[model samples]
Target: MPTSNWNIMVKASQNPPFAAENYSIAEIKNEVLLQIRSGKDFPVTSAAISLIGQLTSEQEVPVAELANVVLGDYGLTSKLLKLINSVYYLRFGEVTTVSRAIVLLGTDHLRDVALSFTLFERLQTDASDHIINLLCRAVYAAVVGRRIASQTGYTNPEEAFICSLFHTLGEMLTAYYAPGTYAALSKGITGSGAEESARVRTSLLYLSLGKEIAQSWRFPARIVCCMEKPTVKMSEHDDVYRLSCIASGANEVAHIVEESLDPEDRQRKLEKTLKNVHLSASLISGNGDLTAPVEDVHKYCSLYGITFERSAIARSLNQRREENEQAQGPLKRPTNNTAEDAPFDLPPNFNGSSSSPFSSLPEAQDDSETVFTNGLREVGDAFLEECPLDDLLTIILETMYRGLKPFGLRRTLLLIRDARRPAMEVRLSLGDPLASIKSWFSIPITAIGSDVFNIALSEQKHLFVNDSTVPPIDGQPLIPSWLVEHIDRPVAMGVLPLHIKRVSIGMIYLEGEKNFFTTVPQNYLNYVKILHQQAAIAIRQR
Candidate 1:
């Protein structure tokens, strides 16, 4: 359908891709340690902190002077001045000085200016998507800040808006410093063949980077907190969290017409995200008269030269109604299955028998096939319609664990998309006390240093580790080592790629006992595939 909603176009299930540098914190830490050991001067943390203050100040700073302060030994003032005048910064009049521009932006904004300049100066290289992406983000953030100020009530809304806009700074920095780590994460998630989950995982990874960088820069505690929990945190009084939420929400809405999203899906996702973040639905409904007289949301959009119409609200709302009707109607799954629908057969059990789920059948033959038996199909369907999205996922994982018990598989790990961190977060754990930690920090899946991550994600294929002697994937070596050494307990593990359509969603890790396949069954792989399909749909709705 021709919809004007950006969120629907972007797909809430798939968060925008973020550079996975943040989730690569361990690698960064290692680099820091090595630099310290080698006595090589690492980038001074103080420099990052100082740069923030300088950028926010109102000094009309020149690019050269700004560069001088940030780049330290570099005398690239002229080049910087040129960059400042580029089409990116909408400065008119023949004011050729970087200092003048700095003054106009004000000290409060100088932090962002300095940050923008310093980041570009340090990381600008041919084909470096990190700096380019950060610049795009800066421009996007500034515009978002301006529009948010016009649309909402808050003192110094511009300042608050700007802060919210650059919330993903850490991700850029991490991407620049550690491209390998970021690539690994991207590959692991995308290779999983679930585009939706891949994007969300990327976003989570990006958020993690932003949190780290914000902390590294020692920006305000509230700003840091807001960056960490952009969609989940509560602020004290009129804080950045509120302003950022509104900005993000507005950005989502604005993008619908300006970008692409099924207006209906956009509204639905926004509604849910806002509720999840504890924002009063009234505010997002655009009924709150918080907008100020000087504030021109349309003008702000114009300043950025992006097409946005205030009058489109009516159209958007109507589209949303149509969407609700469709959503409420009978469910018909998309027909074109991506890699997620590929077929594979199960292995045989040891007793020279098929060892299927049914005792009469050979062990392998019994366990391999999954039929729509005994209300399982209905249970799955009901689970889809009634269960809360997150709870639905939890139950699905729990069911898989139970299903594997007959084969002696004990532990299972499921990694799902989390927007706050923008990476694959460990959703549930069958065993292990470490899994209980509520705030399980996510690492870029690509950094796991194992090919298993690649095989599971990219090949959309299952991995069987009988002897644990296999080498690891590019970023997921730990999985193999863990599976092999943990064999003393239960070692049967299966990696299932999850996706909807061509959009990759996420992945599931199932583990049973060492002698798990004593009786292999038919279509066992297909059963898990169904689990992943249902899980993805539930997550998308959530």
Candidate 2:
């Protein structure tokens, strides 16, 4: 039996006054929160059990009425179902629906289920990693609590579930409302304590809040007292005390498993906890092939006629122990997102070289023939196979340099649109390093001297600058000086459209004096045209 140090009425009095003898439904709910933190899982569990009676009685709850309640809190219903489906439930695989969950889990479990629904719903929105971690830890602890209930043959599995689930409700609210402060405290404790650090003190603050809420709600005295003094003695035969012990041990295990504690000390604590529970040390060690899978554990327990209740208590503890053991090893941190994490950048020339008759002339007649065709096919194929998006752009620009070197084209620039920033940023370049080229690489789509920029911005691939003498499109010189100085030689330029799926991607700028194209071999010019199309497709896909 559970004992109490605080009166339910006294605790309820701390909140708005309410009649305890003939308590209303809201008052009963208020008390439910109190009982949870008080370490008395039974009263709340009992109330949930009582609800089962009401639900199944001759006056069955109207299906529409139940639907409205469930829809009002869809997340709660979902979580309840998930919990029911978890390894915690005895019927494990068969039951699924909320209605079924209520029937199988009982009224006592339902109340606790409702509490868990509210608890996590609140925690998900919290910003503090510390509190979030604590929330996770608390859930693990709740797992322990439910396991204990199972072992002790607690009739209401949902009550045990709720008790474990909301035992750390204070932590949930703290993480939700004051994450920064919680984070600071967590940092301070971890930095100082290594494995020796104990969060029990920090957690007590939230425990107090749980206690306060329980008292305000007018929960049973058995639970109210436990909330007021968590250290209170439990009878050797007290099932609730056993449940609380399992939860307490589980929380400590979570920290150890996450390696948030000192290695040697964490090991010692875990070993002692396991010994006290008569569990196998190898189960938590996570050594070579020694760990038990949940299914195996279930099988083992069933062989002994052990209910899921006891199995849950045992399994969660051991799992956390294994997690802690793993955490004891050196930590591996994730680095910044690299090119490998991104998709490939599609080039404008995905269709390959056109087979048009105009592109087969000899090199001596067409100077631009070798510009983009030289090694263009080989490099483009290699880039598609090997390069990541960031480096792909660089490789594409380099490929352009390799292919166009014989043409005396001297400079090439690639600009790509930034989705997040929604602007054009310079991607690749072939020019003097001192020309502020970096800034030119990623110019805003709305501003720039590049024909590619104009093409992408206007969704037009047919832009052309037949005459530099024409007025600048936006009061700026049509031919940028960067282009003039970087080219190493003056030349007229032709901007031809690059398209993919009828959408404008970018433009290929062919530079040379007028009639230069008449001199360059058509085969090489065809290569440049093909490269442009591939480049357009590549960049767009990225």
Candidate number with greatest lDDT: 1
TM-score of 2: 0.38
Q: List candidate 2 segments past 4 Å from native.
A: 1-68, 81-97, 148-158, 193-203, 217-233, 260-265, 273-542
Predicted model with the maximum TM-score: 2
Report lDDT (CA) for all predictions: 0.45, 0.44
- lDDT by residue (212-316, candidate 1, tens digit) is 556566565555555544544655365666766654553443333233265456456656654654555544434221222111232223233222222233234
Model 2: per-residue lDDT, tens digit, 378-480? 3454454653453444334444443444554444555444567755444444442313565443434454434434544465543434343445555565565
For candidate 1, the 10 contiguous residues with the lowest summed lDDT are 342-351
